[model samples]
Target: MAAAFLSRPVYPGLALVPQARRHIFALEGAGAGALTDLAPDAGALTRSDILYLPRDPDGAAQAVALAALGAASLWQAPDLAALLSRLAGLLDGARMGTRLYAAGSEGFIGQVLVVAEAAGIDPLSVATEHRGNRARRVQCVHCKTVAEEVTTQPCACPGCGLTLFVRDHYSRRLGAFQGVCIDAEEPGSAPAAEEAFR
Candidate 1:
C-alpha cells in the first residue's frame, strides 16, 4: 500500500462508471494510452468526449490512437492551458450523470483536479491513472512560487533562489508538491541535484 499522506493523491486507474450517461476524459501526453487501454465499449465511446494535450512530440502518436477510438469527440489541445480552458467550458455546461477521468504525470492530474474542483465537482470523484513523466510541480514554501516539471530532489527555486528539497507532500488546493529550503540548517551545504522523478 502506498503511504497514506493526507494530501497526497492516490490514483486508482481509469474504470468506466457504467451508470454514467456521459463521459469526459482529460488526458495528457502518454496518458492518452490509459483510455485506449481501457477499450471502452461502443456505447461508452459514443457518449465520450476527450480533451488531450500531448506532453511532448511523441504525444502526437497517442493523440492519433485516441482519435481512432471513435469517441463522440476528441480534441487535441495545443497546450495545458488550452486543455484546461476547454475543460472548464465543458464542465460549465455539463449535464448530470457525467463521469470524468484524468491521466498523466502527477502535475497534470493535479491541475485536472483543480479544474474539476472549480467546476463544483469533487476532485476525489474523478478517476485517475498516473502515466508518463513522474516529474512534479513544486511550490517553494518560503517564496510560494510553483515550479513546473521539477525532476530533482534538491532543486533550485526559480522564484526565490532557494535550494529547495522537494518533498512527497502534496497540496490538492494548490495542485503542487511542497518544497523546503535544503540548506536552511547549514547555508550552502545543500547536496547537488540529481534526477529522482523522471
Candidate 2:
C-alpha cells in the first residue's frame, strides 16, 4: 500500500502536541498505529523538520509519523471525509499534479479521491490491502446458470433445478487503482475501451 509522509514545520521550544488521543486509540485498535511518542531528537528538529512515530506496525506508521511532525492530521471517517480534509491541508502549497500515496482500504481510497476531486488535486495512486469481504459470481447447480454476483450470499443457481455451493474466491477489489479494471494489461496502458476512444 502507498504511505504518505507529510513534513510539517517544527517551531523552536514548542513541546510535542498531545491532541488526537481518541483517534490514536482507534488507530491502535485497528492494528494500525498510535502516536506513542515524539522522535527522541526534538531539539534537533527545525522548522523544516518534524517527526511523528507510529506505535503499531502497519502502513499507517508513515502517516502517524507525518502527523507527529505537524505536517498532516489523521482524519478518521466512517468513510473518507476526515482524510480528505487532512490531505487538502497537507497539500496546500504543493504544486499541481503532485503525486501522493494514500494507504487504506478501498473505501478509504474512494473517500480520498472524492476529496481530491473537490479540491482539484489529481492523486497519482491509492494503496490498500485485500482484507475485507467481496462479491463473487458462482454457477448455480439448479439452473446451470451463473449466480448473480452477491456479497456473502450462497450460490443458488439462477437456471433450472440446481444448488451451487460457495467457494473461496480471490477478489481484486482492494489492490492498487487497477483493482477495478477487468481486462489485465500492461501497467500503464489504458483499458481497451479508453484506448478505442483515442
Candidate 3:
C-alpha cells in the first residue's frame, strides 16, 4: 500500500532531483558510507534541479532540510520529513506560492507534518497509505557499487564497500495525496469512499 498528497498554491512545474555527493559532503566525518547510489530512474531525473541527500545514517534530517530550501516548490520521494524543512525554507524566503509533493513512508509523512507545524508552515493537506508493489533492490548509497535487496536492516555498499542502511523508502501514494490526484481504487481511498459508503 502507498499514499500520496498534493499541496496547494500549485507550484510551477520544475524537475527536482537530489544530489548524492552534496549530501555525502554534508555528512563528512559522520560516517564512511554516507552516500547511496540512486536508482537509474532517479539518476535520470533531469529537466529539474537536483539536490542530493545521504541515504544512510540520519539522511532524513538532511533531506528534510534540503527540501525546505526548495525555491520553485517542494517535492519529496516519500521519505520521512517529506522534505518539509526545504518547503518551509522556500516559503519563508518569499511568498512565491509554492506547492509541495511528498511520497514515501507513513512515518516520514508524519514527521514532515510535525516539522512543518513547528516551523509555522501549514501544509495544504495530507493523505496516508502503504507503498504499492514490491520494493526494488538498489545499489548501496554509501559505496554505490553493490546492489542489495531493500531491507530495514543496515548493510554495506558493494562499490565503496561501506556499511549502509535503508534510511527511507520512497512512496508514490504520498505524492498523489498531496497533489490530490489519488485514485478512488487506490488502497488509501477511504476519503473518497466516504462519498459513497457513508
Candidate 4:
C-alpha cells in the first residue's frame, strides 16, 4: 500500500548529475585547516582574499584569525536578492588570485555558485561544501518554472499544472534538474505522487 502513494513509472535511471569534477574544499564543513589532503595556511588564503558562507563558520574560523586579511563572509541566512546585490560590488573590482569558498546548505552553495559564475569566476578557483538536507533545484522545461528545495521524484509543476518526472541530469545553465512530463505519452495519465522525494 505504501507503493500506492509513490509515483509510478519511476525513472530510477534518469537522475544523472553533472560530470564536472568539483573542488571539494570541505565536505564535513570542518573549515580549511582541517581539509584532508590539502593544507593551506589561513594567512595565505586570507592574504589572497576569499569569500565564504557565513553560516558554516567552520571554514571561516581560520579566516577570522587574521584581522587585516581581505575576507568576505556571506550571511548564514542571506536574502539571495540582497546578497547578490552586495556581492556584485565586491565582484566588480575583484582582483586576480581571489578565491571563493562556500560551506553551508546545498541551496546556499548552489545559489552562490550562480552569482560567482555570473561574475566570471572560474569553477576551478572555487570550492563548495554541501551541508544540510539533500534537496534539489528543479526547473520545468515546459513552462520555464523553477522549483526550489524539491524533495520528490515525480511531482506536479507548481507553475503550469503539469506532472513532471525529474531527471537525474543537471544543467549548469539552468542550475536545476530537468523536469519533463512523465505522462506525456498518454497526455493526462500519471503515476501516484510520492509522499517524499528523499
Candidate 5:
C-alpha cells in the first residue's frame, strides 16, 4: 500500500509555458482536449507542433478539432505505435527552448516520459496530464513481458503464463507496474482475477 502511494504519478495538468520558444504536444485519445482548452495565443500556436493519436470512439472528431487549432504542424497518427515513432523523431530534433507536453492515460503518459527520457529531456521539465481510462501497463517480473493496458488484478502474464498480482511499484524505465506471481509459494492458490485498474 505504501509502495502504491509512493509510486503513483501525480499529473498537475498541462499549461502553456509562455516563455518557451517552441511547444511540442504529444496527445492521445481524450488528451487532445487539454491542448484545445488551453486556447493558446497565436504566437504560441505558430511555434507549436502537435502529434496526436485518437484512441476513442469520438477520436475522428477530436482529430479534426485539433487540426483546426492551427499549430505549426499537426500530425494525426493512425495508431499509438506510429505516434510514438513520430514523437521519437520529433524529440530527437527538438531545440533547446522546446517544451514537451503530454496528455493521455497514465500508461500513455509513462510511454511519453520514457521517450522524453531517452531524448535527454528532463522529466521535471515536461508537462503531463492524465485523461481518459485508467488502464495500466504491467510488466511481469518472472518473464519480463510488458503488457499494455492491463485493467485487472491477478492478470495473466502473456509471456510466462503466471497469474500475476499487479503491484503499484512502477518502473519509469519500463513504463509499467510490477506484476509478481500471486501464488508462487502455493502454485494453485492464486485468487480470482478482478477488475482493478479499469
Candidate 6:
C-alpha cells in the first residue's frame, strides 16, 4: 500500500551490533525488576547517555523506568531538536565505554541513530525500542533540510518551499525519506493530495 512506501528509512549499519561482547550488559537483561530501588529521574548516565524525548509520554515513562531498572543515569531531552544540539557536547568528553539507550517514535528513534552515528558510538553499546508508529521523517531533496514527522505528501518543503512528493525511496544516511518536487517538471501541476499521513 502507499503507507509501506511512505515508511521511514532503515539504516542497517546503525541498528545492528556485529560484535557482541559478554562483558557488556545485555539490553535484553535490563528487566523491570533489575534496578527498582533507583529513582526514575535520577540523572544522566555517569558513563553514558540515556536520551529520550520528553514530549512523548510513553518515551518519558520508559526513560524513567529504565533508570529505575538500573539504567540509573539519565538525561531528559525536551525535544529532538534540543537533544541533537546537546548531544555534541555530551560526546565531546564521553568515553568509548559509554552506552546509549533510545526509545520513542520511529522519527525520534531514527534521528537518535543519526546522532549516535555522528557521535561514533559503537552499535554494540546502543539499544533502541520503538514506542509508536504513524510518524515519519521527510528530507528535502533540494536542500537536505529534514522535516520531522510530516503527516502529508505534497507538503511544502520546510527548507526550500518546494512542494515535495514523498517517494518510496528512503536514505538511511539521511534518516529520512526521499522527496522530490511534485511540480518539478511542470509548475502548478500536481497529483491529487491525500488528507494526511497517519
- Per-model CA lDDT versus the true structure: 0.93, 0.33, 0.32, 0.53, 0.90, 0.55
Best by lDDT: 1
Task: Output the TM-score of candidate 6.
Answer: 0.63
Q: In model 4, where do residues sit more than 4 Å from their true spots?
A: 1-77, 195-197
Better of 3 and 4 by lDDT: 4
Candidate 3, residue 123: the lDDT equals 44
Assess candidate 1 and give its lDDT.
0.93
Q: Which clashing pairs does model 6 show?
A: 43-74, 44-74, 151-197
| Residues 1-198 of candidate 3: C-alpha lDDT, one tens digit per residue | 122322212322122233322111111111112122222233332212322324555556655654444322224334323345454554355332332233323333334444445556464332222222223233443334424233323433446544344333432323211111122245333231111100
> Which whole-number lDDT from 0 to 100 does residue 175 have in model 1?
91
Q: Give, for candidate 1, the lowest lDDT window spanning 10 residues.
A: 1-10
Name the candidate, 5 or 6, with the larger lDDT value.
5
Worst 10 contiguous positions by lDDT, candidate 6:
21-30
Which of the two, 5 or 6, has more TM-score?
5
Ranking by lDDT: 1, 5, 6, 4, 2, 3
- Output the TM-score of candidate 1: 0.96
Q: Per-candidate TM vs. native?
A: 0.96, 0.30, 0.27, 0.63, 0.95, 0.63
Candidate 5 has its poorest 10 consecutive residues by lDDT at 1-10
Task: Please give the RMSD to the true structure for each candidate, in Å.
Answer: 1.3, 15.2, 17.3, 9.3, 1.5, 6.7
Candidate 5: count the clashes.
0
Candidate 6 C-alpha error for residue 61, in Å: 5.6
